[model samples]
Target: MPMAADDIETLIRTAIPDAQITITDLAGDGDHYAAHVVAESFRGLPRVRQHQAVYAALGGRMGGVLHALQLTTAVPKE
Candidate 1:
């Protein structure tokens, strides 16, 4: 079974309470997804680190219950 968009969003929110997340199914399957997230936690983090934070939010779900995630993270506009 693949992950649900709501699950992805929930995971992100669980980690970053103020996160704004948008999830799209890249392959029309739940296994492949693209996530665009904006959070205050990313304010000073590098792009790689920001992504890492989001991945961590998923609790290592990448490549297992969740197959692939194309992630984009940003801090909220000032």
Candidate 2:
């Protein structure tokens, strides 16, 4: 079964408590998603590391319950 968008957001929120997350279903199917996350903790991190953190927040579901995720991360605007 495909994962719900709310589940994805909840997982990220659990890990990165201060994250500002926006999830969009690129396709009508729930398996493909795009996530844009903003967080204060990502301020000094590299882009790769920031993305990794968001992926990690989803636990090990990347290839199983969740099919594909296009992720973008950034620190909050000043």
> Candidate 2 lDDT, tens digit per residue, 1-78?
999999999999999999999999999699999999999999999999999999899999998999999998999999
Q: Model 1 misses residue 74 by how many Å?
A: 0.7
**3-52, model 1: which lDDT tens digit per residue?**
99999999999998989999999999899999999998789889999888
TM-score of each: 0.94, 0.97
Q: lDDT for every model?
A: 0.92, 0.95
TM-score of 2: 0.97
Q: How accurate is candidate 2 locally (lDDT)?
A: 0.95
Model 1: residue 17 alpha-carbon error in angstroms = 0.6
Tell me, what's the RMSD of every candidate? 0.8, 0.6
Task: Show where candidate 2 strays beyond 4 Å.
Answer: none
Residue ranges of candidate 1 with Cα displaced over 4 Å = none
